[model samples]
Target: MRISTRTSISIRSCHVRRNGPHRSSQNAWKWVASRSSVELAGTGGWLLRNGKGLAYPTPAKSNKSMRSGTLIVLFQPNEERLLSAKAMIDDGLFQKITLPSVCLAQHCVPTKGGTIAVKPGRVLGYLDSLKFRLSEGARRHSCGTFHTGTDASIIPDYADFQLDVRTFSENTQKLAKAAVERIIRKECEVAGFPTTPRMVTVVSSPAIYNDAVATSQFTRVFEWYYGRRASEVVQEMPPDIVADDLVLLALPPGGMPIPYVYWNIGVTDPETWERVSREGELRDLPPTHSAIYAPAIEPTLRIVIEALALAALTFLQLL
Candidate 1:
């Protein structure tokens, strides 16, 4: 290292060049003299220019990268509610929710940006939430007061969203239809599906979603496969229909009990339905409670006794 007469300086030192901060050329020779040992490892403390500290290397697999995605669907009024329900079932979302999948009506909210899917067990909740966004498609579905100023506004455009709920309801209904049929047929143990056909009819075509589509679909599916024909109820079809969930058999004319199906696949034949209602003081019992219980022991015992008595009477008459 040397200094020019004009006072500029030059130094030959890659260490200083690589490490920087040689002060001035005046100490260049001094450093070279002491340069006996100065080795650097790839430590970030290279020149130590940054005393503020540095960041450690982070792993590539962050939580943001691994988090599950959320899904939401938008609805236009004309489309049936079941379309989304079916989409979820086909994709297995209800399994994710772990609830009895039903044809529940949904309301959409076009919020800050995304639309939220609001599913209330009862149709009223969905309707109330839908008002959050005034949809161009929401027509005929009036929300207002009725005569006497009674708030009859809750009754929705039954048709408007009836189909929407089919996705949830009919899926359950389809199950209900099969279970009721089986209970009637005496194929399955009564403990699982002890409801009468009368009660079963009421729940499947529940007054709420009981439009022509829901009613006829549920009734047709159940009756065709396992119910007794006319000589009993209205027009009847042959009993070749496919029955699932449980298999039912044809009842004697006016002999079949109505069936009631709950979302949980809990079922009730009519006699059991009445017994449970009269048995329990609580109206708040879940839809599945009666369906889960054994047909009362008393009733079964009575039937057995009656059958024995009839047999003895028949024997005596024959003699």
Candidate 2:
């Protein structure tokens, strides 16, 4: 086999519908060819490396020469809880597999059908789940009585449960954490508690900053291909919704500093999208994470496949 330089690509998805055809994988394999392969047992992931000895013909190719690159696709499970990604890293995912030069991921949103939305700079923010515990006396005395009149009694020891904080910047994340801790401590002091309230972090995920140059280049390409179907959204994202995969890729072990792109594609049908568009709000739309929230599958799959294939080909040309 001929030895050639390899460019690694990584694909990750939070959720994959069961019992449906593997449209993305099939389209990807058909679009790109490779000589060597490695599969992750039970995860349904693949690592494909293309060398000079093997040729994968594409529309861009003039001759029969093969392109040099590697593509690693990772399908993450347990998307609802967002825990499987962290588990994979702890198990040494990047250490065992080839590291990608750049990482790419996309989400299905409730926007108008065929629309692609993206933004520069910080595409997502940091997410942290904090828990606060307070004794019965602290709660009753500081906040309020459990009941009124004769029925009034001290509240049982309780915790604030899960308080989620999303910060757009690292500095903001630090300030938010500190402010939360300070507020809890002050409440305990005011309640005359013998000890300070306990604070715990249930989960923490960092923010993602897209590379400016790379983002601009891709935005033009998307607009050129999709025209009116592509857009750049200026609205802020909800803080509690953490993008764990991109955050994990930005950190150690993975340590990929190259440009990373995170974009959104609409999953709603044309009729529903038109209705929501006419209404001028998403209140009528089924929001993500809701039991009723379901995306139109066929169109979604086709759009996603096309976007991924185009992105891979564009990046390969640069290589």
Candidate 3:
């Protein structure tokens, strides 16, 4: 893909595919980052493309970067989102939005009127992980993942997490996986995407996960991530191709329900949710990292649920 004049911006989308090499048929698209919000870098140059996927390389310009974000929910990206992203010379969306947040008790009620007497922050914790390459900041988190789709059946996804899993092997893995499961289901059950923002590189990578779960945990992680039995979303979201950042979009058909429900939960680490501070008394603690896995479909539903619930409660009080 060539843009003669900077004004003639044309960014083509790439779907997820196999690990195989780029085909001769694949056209190269230029991704030039903006030096200033109003400026474009690649006035005349071939944008770099390699194993790392697509990028709009910008020259060292103004010392600052514009990290604007957008969240959108649509069946498919209409032309506008793509154009908006390209026009901005986005670094990459995957890296920009995948952030792990504290899982607060939003919808549920005051359970422990008779509920378990667990300390606040102690019984509730959110944990996730990310692994990357040997690029600029490759030593730590990756520069964002490859397009979820490649030569193989292409698909993509993303989200974020932070958990502390230590002690017995089973306990750590189990609790970690449980948090992931609840999140995906709840996300699919509650919220959604932003208005529609482009992507960006992290400029740098921090140690994404010194406490990343072992590869053995892949199956269990996949199960919880999709809120389905293992391999449920495998065809589209294969495990091997997954990288640091995941861009999942849940649009059109407006929203949907989770076909899977939690029939039973294994023994949960009663103390897993406790929040720990570096200054607080030290105790034997397990390693942890943020898991940013964004699934477009579920999060959208999650947002809808929250909105509806608030509306309902407001209506009831009126009566």
Query: Which number leads on TM-score?
Result: 2
- For residue 34, give model 3's deviation from the true position in Å: 22
Local distance difference test, per candidate? 0.24, 0.54, 0.23
- The total number of steric clashes, by the backbone 3 Å criterion, in model 2 comes to 1
Model 1 misplaced regions, further than 4 Å: 1-218, 229-272, 280-284, 287-319
Off by over 4 Å in 2: 1-65, 80-82, 136-160, 227-243, 254-256
Cα lDDT, model 1, residue 226: 32
For model 3, residues 1-319, the per-residue Cα lDDT tens digits are 1000011122443332342111111322111122113232322211121211111111111211532221111111122122332322243432443322110111111111111111111222222332221112222333244434343332233323332222223356456556655554555435333222222322211111111122112223334544543332212211111111111111112233111100101111223223333335224333111122111212222222222222222222211
lDDT (tens digit, per residue) of candidate 1 on 106-201: 111111111111111222111100101111222353444322224564433221111111213445656655554554446323423232222212
Decoy 2 TM-score against native: 0.68
Q: Model 3 lDDT vs. the true structure? A: 0.23
Residue 10 of model 1, lDDT score: 14
Best-fitting candidate, measured by lDDT?
2
User: Ten residues in a row with the worst lDDT in model 2?
Assistant: 45-54
